[model samples]
Target: MRNICAIIVVFFMACSIPGYAQPRHSFALGDSVFLLDNRPFQMICGEMHYARIPREAWRQRMKMAKAMGLNTIGTYVFWNIQEPEKGKFDFSGNNDIAAFVRTAQEESLWVVLRPSPYVCAEWEFGGYPYWLQNENGLVVRSKEQKYLNEYKQYLMALGKQLAPLQVNHGGNILMIQVENEYGSYGDNREYLEINRKIFQKAGFDGLLFTADQANDVARGFLPGSLPALNGIDNPQRIRQLVRRYNNGKGPYYVAEWYPAWFDWWGSPHHVVPPEKYTAQLDSMLSAGISVNMYMFHGGTTRGFMNGANYNDKSPYEPQISSYDYDAPLDEAGNATPKFMAFRSVIQKHLPPGQTLPDVPAAKPAISIDDIQFRETTGIFNILSSPKINQRLLTFEDLHQAYGFVLYRTKLNGGAKGKLAVMGLRDYALVFINGRRAGILDRRLGDSSINVEMPQGSVTLDILVENLGRINFGPYLLNNKKGITQKVLFNNQELENWQMFSLPLDDINAIKRSAAAKKYTEAPVLRRGNFNLVKTGDSYLDMSRWGKGVVWVNGYNLGRYWNVGPQQTIYVPGEWLKPGNNEIVVLELIKPQQAILRGIEKPSLSN
Candidate 1:
């Protein structure tokens, strides 16, 4: 065994050279620990998603992680952010993960890539591109041939960009994870095995691993790899769970230790005391077990990127725009009490003579002058040609994701009867003859909404908003938004509906819609301008507004509902230009007396 280790070290030594891809780096799975270059290695890692932060700010965040006494960086590669369209891949700007890894390497930090094609990080559709639904009979997170084919295609394309970055090839990547938390989802050894094969085939070879909660550990791990656990407390229990699957050896690992939790719209802000998880973090280190902070820094979920949730027991619950997670580092990357507490714990656990860097300077944030919308636009006026279908279709069927869809039909006989739509994907406003009759909110879990038919050939319009797609659990596979089935009035199915795809991918349609002469209702796009002699980080207070999306200088900040949990949309200083800037809000409900202001802090629970 010693000779084998020596030979492996010699081989890697021969390969480690400046700028050489896959230079001789040796990282292997020992009885229960990770062996790097024949030595027991400990990983104090921090998890953050590159897609959630701005491209320009990646380095700053990494530096922040380092200052917090972290040796490694962990991140999930979001599939939807890269492959917004089918067969088309993006690897530039904020989606440039290879660049993100290389930048981490510059900071002398190793990386653990959670390349789960199904990463359920409170993201839309668990990071699966919405276009995947367009494939007929395609089942995700399974061994289905078509699904695997697409998965392989995406992995191969991703590999072409990231394969060379493995530590063995001279990069800093320590391990690449398979599908995330599979045990909690199901028992599919075959599926995980396929995942392992494809990852190795794609050149992500260093060490492959699986991570799961305690309840699902039995099936989350595969043979020939390290098994890791995720939880908030009970460090000893975390070690025990990993050992249960790894032959009771040393070098126990916890992949995700939650210091805070995520929040959904309309719910109270989720928070935790600094000692709640930090104490457990200290315990894990003291016990000689390595752990990764699930979210050292939780950033924003800008645009229509936020996901939704629904099940047999619960209504459709959409995540708030901010991915803040109430973590050690706030949404704006400011270190909170949790950050200071963790740093103190880590300081005591550091190897002799190893010192953590000082915390970085905080950016200044301020309130800007209030802005108002002088011009108005109607959604109906500026839309692409409608797709004529006998029945209503899903967003994927219409090649749309993360926006609104309008389904319009005419009541020929001016019928006066009870109207009910079955299985509304999310929220919708029922309209009769251009006036809102009632609203259908999936959050209430009530698929049926009453609608009164008026006299004289009334036109019926149902505008549905795709709050977000579910990111986890049994409902993950079928999270297509918009109307799933048909509408019914008096037990009679309605037909001949013209559906308009309001994807809101770009504001061009909204800009053109400004020509609309008569705009006097909700779902109206209000425009305003604000001037700033100087610019810094700030949050746009949406307290006076109803539920809808917001845009600044044509950039979608994200969805802001009047719900108490999240009342502000984070606007970074870099996104602002000195002088004048534009602000647009799509108030879907009662367009309040538009009183918008910029504040220094987020009123999450207010």
Candidate 2:
């Protein structure tokens, strides 16, 4: 009787435990469908990025995904965040992608990893390191040997962390993606083939697939690999596209179905109603088509990691710090109406006797009001020594990736006309002798400003901010922040400038001023502290503040502007301590009030 009880216990354990009890399984791409352990499987996946979400909240987010009836989680591997500098790789802390995948498996979910070296997820430089621009004649997302070598090095390093997790290796990773949406970039079949071989050599020995728009499948498709579609919602269209690309076979997959959209600064917040896509989602599932939501959750594009978009159709539109893509799960991992809409559709399609787990509770939120600044200092107070040069050097030339840079020069007495920075990358604040002059914004195509100088040798300072590199379209290669061209005064080139690198990666290194300086239009750093008795997910409302960046406890919480769209910065409670938590703000423009507050919910709009 004891032996019988033991056998029954083991049987229940195997049946109930999510991933712990499952044995090693085989996942293969048959001619018609995906087979998991010799049985046809439909992948209901949701896209989430590890870099966007805080490391502490990864497990809870994955559990949320499982409860939403998602059998798989899709994620993009950002190369820039992983390898900030050439040959220096960091795969720990928030970047511990191996841990992210393991947690997904622990929640009984498979992973479809998109480790494309060039991922245009509206991330900076399309995931290419800014230093890549410094390489001589190296074109990214091409067959350029210099770019290819760097790509291979990054892929190999990343594979070391994830390749072993493939399903065949007793891990939950199902397949790996090649170069992302290459069809939209170029019709380089040769480059696509090279990318495929690189993945195999890197030890990814599972089904490899290429995802593209329906029309792009022909160009981005490589022989002997699955062709997945993106944004194609119609069931018949999906089947037709997959069949055409897969030699008249099956296994139709929609890799990126965008239920909603991402927003940019100065634009209205993008919110799509659940009714728009609910019917399509239900139809797709009823037809047995595998689908992956573009962003199940877009946590946040914290720090200077946000990317921008530039082309003929639109002006320079930099992505806001909040990556809340209006997804099923909101920015703070709270399930939305859209979540239930998608979950309802996904739940109906589950196999016989299979049921989704209960949805986890939303992360707790606490509010703190009337946070006051204890100290303030000028932007120049934080500057170190300057690199004086004849010609203006870019941020990359000075070995700086993100953040602001100061370009200072002395104009001779009465030496002023239309001050023109020929190629101002993004935005710049002009000052004359410690006084705010005018603004040169790339978004407005304002490079030259009419100015009159005093009859003394006054100092000219142009503080340029890297809004974000161009992430999409043909202008990607031309992304170099700071003054890329000659600075001209009245059409004559200005020279002998002093360059200061303000790569504010270490906010703690900044020493606050002993006395509070008089608040002016010039940029200033405001420091404050707040004690938290309890900690949870919260948003720091920047509605009362002007243009600036925020840092809580030492983590850079990205940028905030009075501009419409995103008005709060997400502060993960894990980054906070129960005692005194420090808060720092670098305000470019003087706000009416130096007061801030921690609000329970996010105020994404103006």
Candidate 3:
């Protein structure tokens, strides 16, 4: 009897060896029969990029997904933020991918990891590190050997942390996407296959899938092996995808179901009605098809990572610092009415006896006002300091990644005809002797403009604003700040440009003093004050101001322009202080003062 008991115990141990003991299940594309664990398991997911949401808030967001009856959480691991420099990887702080996946596991949630080197999520440079732009003759997201090799290295390093978590390895990671929506770019089967090989070599032997809009599935979807998920608003499109990829087999998914949208610098704040979202979500849930909310939580862009878009005709447009996405969860992690409504819909569809945990309390909002600030150093002092390179340097050359770059040059022999910038990325403000003369914007693609030259050691100031990095299309690979080529006067290249790297990563680095007086070509430190007893949410109107950035009580509010669209800047209540808050404005165009007023709602029509 003792020998029989021992045998039984050994058998139980062998059966319970985590994911290893699980049966080898085959997931294949078929007519209405995509299988998970050899069963037709539908994927109900909520999309949230790990890099976009704060690491501390990962669990909360996952909990929100669970509460919405989502069994899967789809996320994109951004390459740029994970590896800012080539060969140098950072998985710590907000860049922690393993921690994020582990948190999802704790919630018993399956994951769809989209580690796109090109995830056009309105992020800075479409999630491609600005350092990649520094590579000579680099053509990103292409068949180029150098680009593919570097991408492979990034994948290899990323796989080290992610491969262990895939479902084949017994973790909750369900499927890994190859590249983002490739159909939108071009039909490059060779490039797609290369990406697939990279993942396979990385030890990710799990199910693979591709996500694209309905029209793009034919071009974007990998043929014959991996199933394709549609990113669409209509439910009927699922049948179309099933016909194309899996001969009528179901378990279809809406990889990116948009519940909200993103806002840009000059455009007014956007808000999607809860009723419309409810209807769309209801249809997907009723159809028994799995869906993922594009962004259940859209966090802040923070620094200079906000990306933009420029059609061949339209002006170069950049996004705002706030990536709120008008999502169910706001930037501060508070649940909106839409969250409550969606939770109700999800509870209706949950399995028997499955109840969502209690909702988390909203973070307290603070109101700060009457803050005071003083500017110390002017543009001239910075220009006089020294030069990093002999020739006029772009933002990329100084190793300064983003934001505005100020280039100054003295008028030689008092000869200045048509001052022209070879390749202005976005916007440029030209000043002569501390006065604004003219402005160049990328919308017009104006290479050179006529400028007047004053006599006797005149100072010339050219302030360049990184409008926004292109987040999609072939243009995505071409991301750099400042002048790409050279500045010229009368067809002659100008030399000796004093470059000031103002990639303002830190707001506390701003110098303030009353005694320091320095000259600048267009030096204007516009100041204002407001009173607040207790800080509440407010939008600071920055519409009247010319091109420049703003700071509230020393916190950089982000770049603003007089251009239409995003005129009012979002000032989070958490960033504010109670009573006597100070505000400072730095306008590149001197002599123009700006007035700021607080509004309850975000400014929509600048």
Candidate 4:
């Protein structure tokens, strides 16, 4: 009887159901479908970035993804946030990606990890750490040896945190991407292969793939690896491109299906109507193709980390801090009309025996109508000790990433002629002896201006704003922000300059500056308070204020410009309290007593 009972237990263990069984095999590429335990698998993936959302709110976001009928979640590991300085890395706090992936696993969702060292997600420097600009003669996203060595180190560090989490090791990561969308910038096959070898060397045993736009696949495709397409939901076109470039063997995947678009400063706010995407989604699901929404949810681009972009003949357009991206889930994590429409589409595509969880309850949002400001300060209120240089230096040269840099020098013969600032990163507010002279805006492609000098020696000051660093294309190699080169008066270069570093990546120092001076510079700060019996999410109306940045209870909410599209900065309820909450605004100019109000919905693309 004992022997018979033991035999029964063994039989049950061996005949465990597939649902209860361990993943028989790690995810692998099939000839035309992703194979799981040698059976075909359809990946319904949604993309979200851990850096964009609050650390405390990560698990809730994961639950939302699962509730949306997605079995897979995709995210790009930001190199700048992970390894801000060379050889220095931070995986704690909101930068803790390992914690994020584990949370996804707990939520029963698989992960597609895209660790783009050069992720052009409208992020600063295209996700490259600004310090990379300091590397002597280094060309990023290239086959350059110096760059590859550094890139190799970064990949290894990431692997240590993520490799064990892959499906091969009993974790949930399905595959990891090589570099992000390289073909759009160049046809560097050697560089693409190098990235593959680096990922392999880092112990990534699951799978590796490259993502590129459909037309650029031929240029970006790596031999012997899977190819992923990013763009509109044209399943047929992507299928053909992958079959042609991937040797006719494909599980055709749409890597970045666009449901919404990104925003830029001074550009109209972007919104992609839900109807524009529903039909395409239906067709892809009907065809059984795997799809990953580029921005299933876009949170926010807090801090000075938002990137800027420019063309050969155009001005610099910095990305706004509110990444919102007009995704299904808005910046504040509230579901929109599009979210409801998208839910039905996802529910229709689930496989047999699968069902989506009900949508989570929406977070409450409150409106504060009578907010008031009581204190103010100027940007140049407190100055850092200056570094002397024969000519102006770039931000990277000073080991700084983002913020304002002040360049001051004296002219013995009084400056004259066209005052040209060689390689101005973006914008500059020129002032002479503490008075506004003129403006040099990169958006208008203006770097030099006519200056009429009066008799005696005069002081020349150029407060250059490192609007953002370019994160994509050929220009990415030389994206050293601030004054990249020397400043010139007429045809001659200026000398004996004093440069100050004002990287406002941290607002603590700025808060102290606000205490010293009420108003001193072009950009200024205004302080106020509002009360609430309860706290939730809200949008601070920027319709009345000029262009600048905002902070709530010491948390920087990002930038605000009167320029339409995104006029209100999102304020998370997590940062609020029941009784009193303080609000601070960095008003660049035009300071006055203004009444501020908080609203429930966003006013992007103002």
* Best of the candidates, TM-score: 2
Q: Each candidate: how many clashes?
A: 8, 0, 29, 16
Question: In model 3, where do residues sit more than 4 Å from their true spots?
Answer: 1-36, 224-231, 379-392, 413-417, 444-450, 490-492, 506-557, 562-606
Stretches off by above 4 angstroms in model 4 are 1-25, 412-418, 450-457, 490-492, 511-521, 593-595
- lDDT tens per residue, model 3, 484-566: 88888888787776877766555456554442233333645555677777776677666666666677777666666666566
Residues 1-606 of candidate 4: C-alpha lDDT, one tens digit per residue: 999999999879865532233453558888878986678888889888999898778888787877777889999999999999999999998899988988887788889999968889888888889888777878888888888888999989998998888887777888888878878888978888888888888888778899998878888889887899998477677678888988887888889999998888778888889988888888887777899998988999987888877777666788888888878887877677777788788888777887888889988898987787777666667567898988678888889888788888998655468889888887787876666667787877788988877668777888888777887677887788788777888888888989989876666666444533322345666778888999888998888887677888888788777765688888888888998888877775455545789998878865
Superposed Cα deviation of residue 369, candidate 3 (Å): 2.5
Candidates in order have lDDT scores of 0.83, 0.88, 0.72, 0.82
Which 10-residue window of candidate 2 scores lowest in summed lDDT?
Answer: 511-520
Estimate, for each residue in 343-381, the C-alpha lDDT of model 1 and write its tens digit: 899899888898999998887898987786687776666
TM-score of every candidate relative to the true structure: 0.94, 0.95, 0.83, 0.91
Which ranges in model 2 have alpha carbons more than 4 Å from their true place? 1-23, 514-520
Q: Comparing 2 and 4 by lDDT, which wins?
A: 2
Candidate 1, superposed: residue stretches over 4 Å from native? 1-24, 513-520
The full ranking of all candidates by TM-score, starting with the best, is 2, 1, 4, 3
